[model samples]
Target: MDFVDLEPEIPDSIQVSRDIVYKETDQRSLKLDIYKDEFLVEPAPVIIFIHGGSWTTGGKEDYLIYCLAYAQKGYVTASLSYRFSQEAIFPAAVEDIICGIRWIKAHASEYGIDSSKVALVGGSAGGHLAMLAAYTADESYFASGCDENAVSTAVQAIVNIYGPSDLTTDFAVAQGATPKFMGATYDVNPDIYKVASPITYITPDDPPTLTLHGTIDKIVPITQSDFLDKALITNDVIHEYHRLKGWSHTMDASVPVNEYAQKVMTRFFNEWLNGDD
Candidate 1:
């Protein structure tokens, strides 16, 4: 499915820069769309958005509205495109996200973003990348092919919308995308599955995370978020999990459930990214 070229309902104060190339690999170029409200103070907090297509499809174009929504709320938002599993598997997508964060920080001054106050927000496959990227900042396992820099890739907060947290579970095994993305099954490559799971990297030093999951989600079960929540609590990391009752994966804004999720996500970002708690 193609994403509509629909612009978000943004105020005149907001300005958007489209199709900015953030990284160049030997295989492909990674790009991102940046949005910022000029009315906000200089050096605004940044929000990095990762698009979800189960690691094989989707692009930054699909998330322009989401980027603008956060930009309208006084942030410099970037919706990034990464290498898909079809082109490169396992750590390739994660490495691309890391490089995107580095590119954002390296160009922070030019983009009016504060390098220290960045957050990540994603849904589904993108959510998995966001959480893994944020949690594995100190690990070198998935850092391959990423930019070599002293600049930290750790995000201040994360807003995950029904992302898969554990890759070794039955839920992941049931999904064809998982094996394709990992290039092997849990039994065949147990270490790869464990390393890719965000639940393996959680620590107290990790940033506050907010997860919103639909109880009736069919693609990624609610148990995925439950696994992440348990790890966050065990490590004493600040986090919140909101279980959307009688809801499914596709959450259009016209739906009350999505509206509520937007409110919660906004508040969560305000608390952690904007220091408004």
Candidate 2:
């Protein structure tokens, strides 16, 4: 497949990200910004995107270019901002996403989106949340929102773009890799680490999924995705996976090395989001 870079352009459709605070400690405005393709004759399905920064240092801005790109394709795309471990801890970020999903559902008509067909796409730490959002104990949510229905935030499909799937590995820890969201090893803080991992809640009921990782990725390690993929197979979940060669922890998104990953992830989301696969 021939891959091309997305062009830059300011969008014309209405846009907004509602600020919803899931916790008092996570006092910052956890917002979900929506980008529209148009004020259509009929609303379209939504793709809620969560950005990557190892879960500690990402923002909606990192996804602005992406938001515009997806919106141009007729999907009501949203990018969110969640609190990091520095401000809070595990489950808080997950809860933040739950709140954002609810907010989207509540106002779907305003944005011309179908509340029943939302899909999730997250990178890195955000990927962990997307996985948990679909497979976790449906009732494990904080119960801090309008939807008393615990399963309302369930996404139809999930796209984990190089997220750490399994949290029990020791490679990153043994190598003394720079601490990201799960800063220290589980031995250092077992309880918190366990709570942050998505594998703790995986089940056969998880939605269809798409996963991509660099073979040379060392930051979170491709083994995490391997373990998750194995579990998905054991449980019989529908999924797709892609591994890019010669690609390391991505440094320049504009470089030729990461071009393949970019193309694959977009296609995965397109097929899942558009229901063409």
Candidate 3:
């Protein structure tokens, strides 16, 4: 599908607020864009999207379609921008996301957001960060500079699309972006790679997870999601995996593939974010 095919005609009923600063750091102001129904009377569940760019590029605008679609579906959606690997190292992006979540929850009333029914969604590197932030909500390592007790970072659901689960894996170790993001080679700091891996924090108590990956993906590889699936299963966590066949990384860029993902994600979010367990 062409890129134009992915652009939907956003209805007037849906409102968009762009470049809302969620955090202010010495380096820059982290921002996010929010989408919601203008006439929403009741508080709605929130879905935050993180964009993929090997942890070095991309922005909140990358998931505009997702935010609009979910907003029209009676949910408040946000796409956040975090510090890239080029500007900051490993935990910086993670920390920024946690801060973004906390900011969203803190200002939930302004946006008619149901703070308790929040979820995180991301693709590729974004997915990895989403998983890390969601799974380690209670861990202080990532919440270092923020007031950890002020607002909770815990989310109800997680959606990982072609995201790498274990950075310590051979594939991840060999990736140039992986080491760059970590600020060290796997040989120099294996522990950092392990700590940054989303699989490391998986537990039965973690939020329900949904993962989608193309079997033919050469970038992140299908094995990343496979490893995540296995770990989630072993932990008895509620999880779903969609291994799309004959597709490559960023397969969602295709209209049909994106639509399929939207369908699956809508169902997953509705079930887990609506008190359905």
Index of the highest-lDDT prediction? 3
Cα RMSD for predicted model 1: 2.8
| C-alpha TM-score for every candidate | 0.93, 0.83, 0.96
User: What lDDT score goes with residue 149 in model 1?
Assistant: 62
Tens digit of per-residue lDDT, candidate 1, span 50-159: 98989999989777777777787788999999988889888899989998898898889988999999999888999999999999984676654555467778789998
Candidate 1 stretches with Cα past 4 Å from truth are 1-11, 252-254, 275-277
The deviation in Å at residue 142 for candidate 2 is 5.1
Tens-place lDDT digits, model 2, residues 1-277:
2323433456556454444342243366566667775554567778888877766787866666666666766677888788776776565677777777777777788778888788888887778888877776355545444343443777788888778766656664454322345556667776665666677667787888888777888786888888888888888988887776665554226445345544665676666666221
Overall local distance difference test of candidate 2: 0.68
Q: Model 3 TM-score?
A: 0.96
Candidate 3 residue pairs that clash: none
Q: How far does residue 70 in candidate 2 sit from its true spot (Å)?
A: 1.0
Model 1, global lDDT: 0.85
How many clashes (backbone atoms < 3 Å, residues ≥3 apart in a chain or on different chains) does model 2 have? 1
Off-target runs (Cα >4 Å) in candidate 3 are 2-9, 147-149, 275-277
In order, what lDDT does every prediction score?
A: 0.85, 0.68, 0.90
